[model samples]
Target: MSDDEVLLSHDDGRGVRTLTLNRPHRKNALDDALWRALRDALAAAGEDREVRALVITGAGGAFCSGADISGGPRAEHPTYRMRMLSDVALTLHELPVPTVAKVTGVAVGAGWNLALGCDLVVATPSARFSQIFTRRGLSLDLGGSWLLPRLVGLQQAKRLALLAETLDAEQARTLNLVTWVVPESEVDAFTDGVCDRLVGGPPVALAQSKALLNEGVDRTLRDALANEARAQGVNFATRDATEAFAAFAQRRDPHFTGTWAVPPSLTDMNGSARSPGPGHEERLRQAD
Candidate 1:
């Protein structure tokens, strides 16, 4: 496939975007082209304001079979290739919007790390996960060394990485590696429901909450509390928060249009989003 065809992107206009790994013939393994495409796609998604929630999934039946160890382009300097992966990892991890990994089939090596980079993961019951690096006579990279220990604690993380054993979806869930494990047939619908809930949420509030939670483990109790307070203050200033309050008082559902001030490029809005006025709930319901 052409480089442009390596990844597919779609936006629902209701504030949800999906990036699909399109090299399904190889079970969506990351070749140099797909890796570059994935990184660029993620960077673009992070800057897209209408993308309140993003989903990463694979085409065909598989999530990803990990990096293609076989034939593909190689970076003349190892640092350059590794640096590209680091950029993708950091961009995905620090994106202000929530991201969900809708996983199926196998997610191993860097592919598994890619899913772990997302804020949440929804997977099929038959999904498989593994570090797989040790088996390849290699050590871990792609931030797996840092992420795994945090997610499942040090000992378990060491076991997984060192042994390179495969974990079934349920086992991954038990270890807190996978968020939810649904039947393969229902994965799409289930993921869509998750996206809808996220899309309906206040974007600024969600982003701040995600940021706070991401830092909580590394910060002192006092520091975390201070950070949370500052985030809450920011949330209080958003029009979406005001809309939420008004909707509650009026006994109606809230409509959240993700509008927050940042790099003007991150938002298409000329000003902060204005709270919905009277009859807004009906209009929203009708539009839906």
Candidate 2:
């Protein structure tokens, strides 16, 4: 496939962008070029105000098998190569839009971490996951070390990483790793439904809530409450907030436009509406 085909992007005209990893031959493994492509796609999605939701999935039944070790020798230094992965990971994690990972077959090594980076994960009954790093004679990369512990607790994280144990979809759900275990036939429809709800929600409020939850983990209760106050203050200044209150009173569904209704003078002490924004890895010898 040509470079453009490494990662395929689709916009459904409903504010949902689906990014499919298109390399079926290698289970959509990340080679340098594919990594770059994924990173760029995610970056573009983040910047596009029209994109309210993002979905990541793999073509050909498998999510990904981590890095493409079979790819030929690399001219770049290992650190430099790792920087590419780091960029992709950070971009995905920090993306303002909600993201979903639709997993079918195996998501191992960095591939699993990639899915974990998303806000939600939907996997089929037959889907499988593994840290797969130790088995490859390496340690976790692509934010696995950080994501796993927070997701499944430190002990479970260590077990997965140290043993490189593969877990089926149900088992992963039990560990709180997979958000939803769906049947293959219905998975697509189900995921589309989820995205629709997300897309229909108040965008500014959802973004604010996502940021609050993400930051709440590391913050003190007092600090979290403070942040929540600020977030709600901003939310109330959006047209969406008005629509929601009106909808509630009218007993109808609210149509959120995500438009900022705050006057330029109110959004900032200096009378500027601008607000400060809130703030991956490589293959083995290639490593994931």
Candidate 3:
């Protein structure tokens, strides 16, 4: 692929962002370049105050078939590849904004786990999911081991992983692996409606609620409750929260920009958080 082939398309609509994986010919499989592209795209999205909701999907048909095992070994070697991939996983899991995965055709191996990592998954009836790692003689990565059990419970997770079963959308839904299932024809419309509900909510409150739930399983009850109060405190300081109450009395949908008291920022790999406004990374790249 050329450096400018647009491996990922970052489309912003109103307060929602839809990132489409663009390597359709290979079913949008993750490769080294695509991995870096996705990571940077998400990092930029997190720092976007205007982005209230994020959606990840694939171009053409397939959501993703998994990593591109066909490619020659990357120059960075195996350990480096794993680290970069892990960073991508961690970034997705901890993104301050709500994210949705819109799965269409095949979602297998790491691809299925990618959907699992999202805050919500909207899949078409034709969507297919599988834990295909064993089939390839490779173990799961992309934080699948951590996420699978939490999502479908240990027993079901084991059954899926050990058996490497391919599950249709409805079957996956029954397993609690899919949040919403719609007809293939209506996937886009249905996903858009879901994004509308997300972007219309008080952004700070929505983000805090997402964090609370995602972290709740690991937190002690005392810490979880304490974190809930602290998250509430963070929400209380936002103008959006104030406006939400006013809109409630006015019986109108509240507009949320997903902004808080301070400016929007992103944390670098070094773990320092700094606000650089919108298109910060792009501007930096351009300057370089």
Minimum summed lDDT over a 10-residue window in model 3 is located at 1-10
Segments in model 1 whose C-alpha atoms lie over 4 Å from true places: 1-4, 72-75, 260-288
Clashes of each: 0, 7, 0
**What tens-digit string does per-residue lDDT give for candidate 1 at 1-288?**
376544555665667888888888888888778878888888888887878888988888888888888874565877877888898889888899999999999999999999998999999987899999999888987889989999999999999999999999999999999999999889889998998899889988999999998889789999998999999889865668767888999999998875542223322376554656677666554433
Query: Cα lDDT of all candidates, in order?
Result: 0.85, 0.88, 0.83
Report the C-alpha lDDT of model 2 over 85-167, residue by residue, as the tens digit: 99999999889889999999999999999999999999999899999988777788998988999999999999999989889
Summarize candidate 3's per-residue lDDT along 179-238 as a digit string, tens digits.
999988888899888988887787778889988998998989999999999998898657
Task: Report the candidate with higher TM-score, 2 versus 3.
Answer: 2
Per-model TM-score versus the true fold: 0.87, 0.89, 0.85
Error of 1 at 278 (Å): 28
Better candidate number, 1 or 2, judged by lDDT: 2
